[model samples]
Target: MPYSDKIERRLHLAALVFLCLIPTFLLFARGAADVSLVLVGLLFLTRSTLRHDWAWARQIDIAVLLLALLMLVVVVAPFGEYPGKNLSRGLIWVRFVVFYAAISRWVLVDKLAIRVVCYATFAALMVGALDGVYQFITGYSLLGGQGMVANGNRLTGPLDRPNIGSYLSKLAFGVMALAFVAREQLGEKRPLAIGAGVMVPVLAVIFLSGERAASVLTLMGLVAVVIGLFISGGRARVLSIFLGAVGVAGIGLLLSSSDRIAGRVAALGAVVSDYADSIYGQLALMGWRFFTQNPLTGIGMGSFEKVCRAQQPPESLQFGCYPHPHNIYAEWLASSGLVGTVPWLAFVGIVIWAGLRLIRAGHTQTVLVALYLATLNASFFPFAATQSAFSNWPAILAWMSIGCAVAALNVFKRSCPTTA
Candidate 1:
């Protein structure tokens, strides 16, 4: 039932690795290549089945799964201009369901899934970084790498949007994961915290991605670690040293990179000073308008863009209507409506409960809890839903991660009967 012993349990680690890689980097999959991902998933699933790899198999999360199925049914029901687009949207939902199964059932919670995800994420970043630099040198994407996902930004790192929400999401998990690794290897190893320390520069690049919510999340995560440290009875001196060092370094970097880092310095200031009447007031009005119009089934699922596009005035000064409500809760209420919101809330509550169970069990598996929570930062502050990378993947991953976190806690409790 769990990933206990290899003899009794079969390992599909290889197949699971391919699942994350094959259909990935949608930047590479414009049209035909996109189909390859589905093929790849099938291939991996088939390979594992043939090998009798049922070690990590577990029951699917029924609530999330059914809600997902419901969403898919609505998306491709075929009442729109872009049937193909609807079909694709429908398939993305399917992919989320399939991926949830892959991660929780086959990825094998112990450590492998997180490692593969972390490696794949960093690999994507490094490749994007190189491509961005190349674009800078060549005068174009050459292969059509436009934004961060395309390779790199001209001045900052390679990212598609000005706000690197994806990078921010990734970095927050990466930092927490490193911390988990550090605490585990305390005895005979050099400080694992050193790697976490070095990661500051890479995390800085995430900020340069210009996602304001992500910046706020980063600060909040640090505060979490401080609280965690204090609650665990850590020495005050040790906590002070780490916090002080991180603070000083953070401040120094902020001051040094004021020029190339355009968003934090320019975007916020411009919004507050010259563009206040246009941005915040307009956004607030839009939020209010959405609530007033669709009080019950609040626009259909995945209809925010349709609503935003339809509602905005031609001469409005705000940015083009976004496909999502910046606030995820609003996005959910707006799109999925009350029908979708109930199941989502239930799922989230169960997940949080699972995580809390783990923290109480032991420190070892607590990393999974931290990683899931950190990634949900975007879900809380919502972004464009159409961008599968930032939205669905993390949302799906959160519930799946909880499935494993709960499993880990179970294992821990059994290993030490005292936990019961």
Candidate 2:
């Protein structure tokens, strides 16, 4: 092989390794994941430049550029409380843009790279789920017991909290996408077995973690999958039956073992009744207050903790001020205000619109991409509690998925030129 060809091959291999490790790194060492992503992104950019290949730039939609510009405005607007912190976070956003561009380029150029990523994600989920189960049975995970509950009642797995469920839910979407792709590539029997095998453990872990948002989103994703299968035709009956069985079994297992799940469901009404008194409710109120007070520019990025302390009521003080409103939309409005939020909303809207269009087009690969994007949007729906959108893990995952979907759409257009 030519020297340039060999170099390109090595670069692709390195990219694949880093891509595969993203979920594992996010699970164990988030900081490391960010660093690795940065390196991979730079390498991709270098390769593209050296080869004089810039077509991938066209794959990037206007919404992403507008979002980036909006973030830059937030960084320089002098509205945030902690300029340095906001600047740091802003740099991370730029990193994600670079990461997205790089990943999209890779997906567009390499037919099988995205499949490898899906497989890697599935493997990571299985390992993480098993670790959570182990933690439940023993008093410790393979990593140790720092975050694991000793009673084996509530499984935190490897993380310091039950937040693992949210991450697991995100990965479950990837697994579902993989199963969809596998059904086309590897035939019906194998995909059915793969889907069931991967999903059951994932649902079990989500239930064991007892995170209300994660569990709800996961169930909703399952429902969406069944609907998609029904709409797409071809053995819909068998797939629906299989999915129904898995759903029933998963719910039954949770209801039998997890009092936390039952308790959360039972308390939902009471929690809603006394909305202003709850920690989440109070934080959300604070977010709305910030947005209303500074509708144009808001309090500023990374300023929520400081502002929350000053703005929160005396009763809310007992629950404590949080770094960001535990809600994605509220955090955007509170920190960046209307100026930052409009573009953010547009970005999400475009992604959803594009995903729906792809699903309507009826290609298996594009449909999987659409499903993944749909699941992601549902996971971070505005009314639900969520991690900070500007936070490292959430930001990385969100942008990465967007980039992948965009790239997949590009590939779909190329393969079916009529679609373009």
Candidate 3:
């Protein structure tokens, strides 16, 4: 019966693995296209709940569920005029909570988990990278793809989009983790083959993703892993550092002349412009405006634009719409207000606490995963959580963090089996 349960579990998880990217893939889709991903995720959750073998929500996922409830409260709080948008935001909140939980608990829990996600990420990365390369060569996207690159050798996978960094971050972690597991299970044929098969594509895919930040992250992650290995008496310190440096440099060189990288760096100087400010700065101003107008409850979900227009400098209001604060903290305060802010902060505080605890326990891999997550959080701000709920970010990251923790804990188990 348990065997049957595990089989069923895998089946549902495999379905989730395939279905997870539907939202991102729907970028071409317009008008409530994002809602489709939400619906699909709900169905996935329903299936998971009805399964006999499945337990109640995984502990890590509870935070996301809480986020969903809080979003619902904010949406129905009667603060803003945009009921439709607020409700929709609430729906997205619930959906991401479910999506994150399903993936964390079912799809992305094991060694097979990383492989499956990697395959999907690799496909997308390859297509986008190759498309960019082709555009650079022939001067066009697959079919009239616009703004692939303006005036540099760099490439953009999808126009006006910059999410490949987060994907790359996860992939780098996945590949390194996979390599670790593969070598650990070296006597086993299956792990060996899977790891060997994935290593090349993973490298090629990250290269093509063309995310300079991600390239840096990948190097940083590998270096951390190496330092971890030697510290744990698991592998040679110099070997790890030497190899990590080589990999990071190689990726960085590939993207060095990329306009995407160059342009982003140039844009940094314009990040907080007062007059010629970027959209991000204006969004910040808008966020502050919304918070000021509705300090207690906020202007409701998705009301950033409405509230912004009402208060933004009329000249700026004449420019265009504003959706979200590019900064997650600013956005959350505007939508969720102080009431919702407490839980969000608490959740982050807990994650930091857990990570610190892991390090203190001398769980080398935990420290590695934690450090990666910390540095990544600094750079990306919420790890895909803005679009997702609080639960979703950790859900995705938990796989690597938990896997590393478990593996490291195994090392410190009651009896480190002596080679009798």
Scored by lDDT, the top model is 2
lDDT scores in order = 0.47, 0.68, 0.49
| TM-score per model over all chains | 0.67, 0.86, 0.69
Write out the backbone clash pairs for model 1: 147-159, 147-160, 148-158, 148-159, 148-160, 152-158, 153-158, 164-209
Clashes of each: 8, 0, 2
Predicted structure 2: lDDT: 0.68
Instruction: Rank the models by lDDT, top first.
Output: 2, 3, 1
Candidate 2 vs. true structure, TM-score: 0.86
List of clashing residue pairs for candidate 2: none
Candidate 2 worst ten-residue window by lDDT = 183-192
| Two-way TM-score contest, 2 vs 3, winner | 2
Best TM-score among the predictions, by candidate number:
2
Model 3: residues with Cα > 4 Å off, grouped in runs:
1-17, 20-40, 47-55, 58-64, 74-76, 110-114, 136-138, 142-147, 150-154, 158-167, 170-236, 247-264, 269-279, 317-321, 363-420
Which runs of model 2 end up more than 4 angstroms from their true locations? Answer: 1-6, 53-66, 69-76, 146-153, 182-196, 272-274, 312-318, 362-370, 401-410
lDDT digits (tens) for residues 1-420 of candidate 3: 677567566566655544445423532332233444454456566666556434535364356446645655654445555767676656556555555445545554445554554455445445554555565566556633754443543344453454434443554454344334433432223533554355454445344444444544555555565566556644455656666687767657855856555555455444424423555556566676677777666777767767666655546553466566655677667877766655666655654454345455554344344434433343334422233222333224333333333332222221223210
Clashes of 1: 8
Better by TM-score, candidate 3 or 1: 3
